[model samples]
Target: MSENIALAGADLRAAMRICMQGKFPGVQLYAHDGLTRDGKPTAVAARAACKEEADGRKLQGPERIAALTACFNGKRPDLAQRSECRKEARAKGLDGADLRKAVDACAREARG
Candidate 1:
C-alpha cells in the first residue's frame, strides 16, 4: 500500500471529517470515485486547499485508520490475496501453476 493516499473532492473532505470523529458511515460514498473509468493514474492528486483543513485535525490510531479506510474506498488487498488462494485451490478459473504468483496478480488487480 502507498504511504499516502490522496483524498480529493469536497465530498472526501466531509468523509474525512466524519472519519476523524471515529465514525464511518457504511452507506456513504467516501470518494467521488475510487478508481476512474480509465485506470491510468493509480492515485489522485492532493487538493492543496483541502490539505490545510485535513492537516489541522489530530486523530488516534483507530480514527486515523478509519479515515484512511474510507479515503481508499475500503479496499483490502490482503483479503483479495486470501480469496485468490482459495480460488486457486479449487482449480476453477485460475490456471496459474504458481499459487503465490496467482494470489499476487489478483491482489494487484483489485480496485481501490
Candidate 2:
C-alpha cells in the first residue's frame, strides 16, 4: 500500500483508541485534506457523523470510510522540510514518539 494509506491506517488506529476511550456510540468518519510539510503523514480533517434513525436517535452502521481513502491517495507536498526535521530529530536521537509530538505542535502552530 501507499505511504499515505499506511499513515491513514495508523491515524485510524489511533482515532479508534480515542473513540474507545471516549465511549462514542457512533460510527467514526474521517475526512482528510492537505498535507503537512513533511511527506510522512498528511493532515487529517476528520469528523464523526453518527447515523440517526427516524426517532432522532443514532443508528447502527455498516460503517463508512468516506473520503479518507481519497485523501490518503492524493499527492503530498514536498518532503524537504519534513525530512530536515526528521533528520534533526534523528541526529539528536530524539524519541520517535517525541518527534511525532513535535510535528503535531508545529502543525497546530501553523494552523493558528
Candidate 3:
C-alpha cells in the first residue's frame, strides 16, 4: 500500500510539472469533450445524468426520505429496518448524486 501511494504521488507530481510547464492543453483540461468513456457526447451524458438525479430525488417522498435518513444514520436499531431501507433505495433507484448527497448528509450528522 505504501509503495502504491508513493507511485501515485510520483505520477501526480509528474502531471503537475507538465501542467505547470503549459505542456498540457488548457482547453482539454477544462472541457469535457473526449473525456467520456462511453462515447456519448458530453452534453447528452450530462443531460441524462441530470434527469436521473431528478428522478431519484423525486422518487423519495418525505416519509421515504425520513426512513433513509434514519437508516443512514444508524438510528434504526433493527437490522431489518436497514435492510428495508436498502431495498427501498434500490427499488426507487437511489444512485449517483442523490445517493451521494444522502450518504454525505447522514455521515455529517453522525459525526456531529
Model number with the top TM-score: 1
For each of the candidates, give the backbone clash count.
Answer: 0, 0, 0
Put down candidate 1 lDDT per residue, 13-56, tens digits, no spaces: 77675776565545443334443334322234223222333456
For model 3, the stretches where C-alpha displacement exceeds 4 angstroms are: 1-92
Error of 1 at 16 (Å): 36
Which stretches in model 1 have alpha-carbon errors above 4 Å? 1-56, 74-100, 104-112
Model 1: worst 10 consecutive residues (lDDT sum): 40-49
The better candidate by lDDT, 1 or 2, is 1
RMSD of each: 16.2, 16.7, 16.5
How many backbone collisions does model 3 have? Answer: 0
- Model 2 RMSD in Å is 16.7
Error of 3 at 7 (Å): 9.8
Q: What lDDT score belongs to each candidate, Candidate 1 first?
A: 0.51, 0.45, 0.51
On the 0 to 100 scale, the lDDT of residue 23 in model 3 is 73
What is the per-residue lDDT of model 2 for residues 31-107, given as tens digits with 9 covering 90 to 100?
22232333234333211211112114422232232333222334222333454556766677777799887666654
